[model samples]
Target: MNTTSKSKADTIAKLREKILLMQGFKPAGAMHKRITGLMPVEQAFPNQVFPLGAVHEMISEGPEGAAACGGFLGGLLGTLMADAGICLWISNSRSLFPPALELFGASPHRIIFADLQREKDVLWATEEALKCEGLAAVVTELNNITFAQSRRLQLVVEKSHVTAFIWRKDPVYLSNTTAVARWKIAPAPSISEPGLPGVGFPHWQVELLKVRNGIPGSWEVTWSEGRFHTHDETVRKLVSVRNDVQKTG
Candidate 1:
């Protein structure tokens, strides 16, 4: 490309980003507010801060993967909902017992679980939930989401200041969406803290595959103390960069 073409392309990108900031969407530079109890994730985001009030995603490939993802989110919600009080959990997975969430910090009473049968109903319910300012958070499980649907949720959450977590199970398929972040959660073997013979706190390989206006990450972490702790400090900032490198080299 010529210098003139390259310059024009750069200018357009800057203008687009500027418009997003003007309209109240988070910019990659200005960042956003940080949420409490996500200690290890703080280092993974830009400026050593995590973005709150944004939609996040978790994907898993199998039953074991889905369970691992749920475990991580349950632990996360415990910290996220401590001050907010009420939370709404929407999913078709009857297997997700409310009592299980108590194993984390969020009590079943504080959470309102909506068992929606159809995908459309789940999405509809989730969007309405996000519009409520009284709720601390809304969690939904689905197979996929379109860019348009995600944008609608994003706009609503921006106004309501409610955070949303969308869990897409059994699909490694990636699609474009307006979510602030996307993560892949899979179970990792745990090592007991007290050298006991039984299973310790849940462990997971949490991969921050995408973060809008921020960065991606790969973390082997354990859920303890009501939050996530780093299992390996060596690898970080994971995404397409590493994949592309492998393909070429």
Candidate 2:
């Protein structure tokens, strides 16, 4: 390409980055530096970065699916908490085993879990927690969420820059939400080495059902070596993305 053409391309790229950043996406350059484990999936997002300062919605079929979704979220939490910031988990019917999070690289002490009996209480706590700038992330469980409720959460995160994950446990109807992305996770068979005796690494079939301005696809991801490892059984291509978890001094 000629110099004029090259200059024009660069200008457009820079402008695009600025627009994406304003829309709550990190820059393309930052994606390579900060994203871990899910590079290919992350590329499907605008600006090739995970959407921070926004809410993500996840739905599951039953208890098993819900557990799988939680495990997937655990991996994300590990990365988000790399800076030593605390995470808040609010749920109405909580079944997560906090001790098991060690397998996903999250310290149980860094997570504060609140179990409430009413959905309203869970929503209230979740919204209040998201408003706290000191928090790294917040995960909430709800059977259903309205567009307005999700929109409110999105607005709160935009100002606080805290990520939020909404877990919809067996909702009867899937309605519209203001979430940036919607996901569904199912338990895939575990993988074990030949000499290993116990259950192997946690495997999951992740489906990106809906994303605001990104392509939707499916992949199998495994949590091992303190990071996410993406691979497909049929293709057998293993992609190890950069580890962005903050290192302690």
lDDT of 2 at 245: 16
| Per-prediction TM-score to the true structure, in the order listed | 0.77, 0.84
lDDT by residue (1-249, candidate 2, tens digit) is: 699999999999899878876777776554333447788788778876888768999888888998898889988888888779799999988899998887786788999999899998988898999999899889998989988888889889888988899999998889999899999999986766545568878889989999987899888888888888777543242212111211321
What does the lDDT read for residue 155 in candidate 2?
87
Report residue 161 deviation for candidate 1 (angstroms): 1.3
lDDT of each: 0.77, 0.83
How much is the lDDT of residue 129 in candidate 1? 95
Q: In order, what is each prediction's RMSD in angstroms?
A: 7.5, 7.7
Candidate 2 stretches greater than 4 Å from native:
1-18, 28-33, 194-198, 232-249
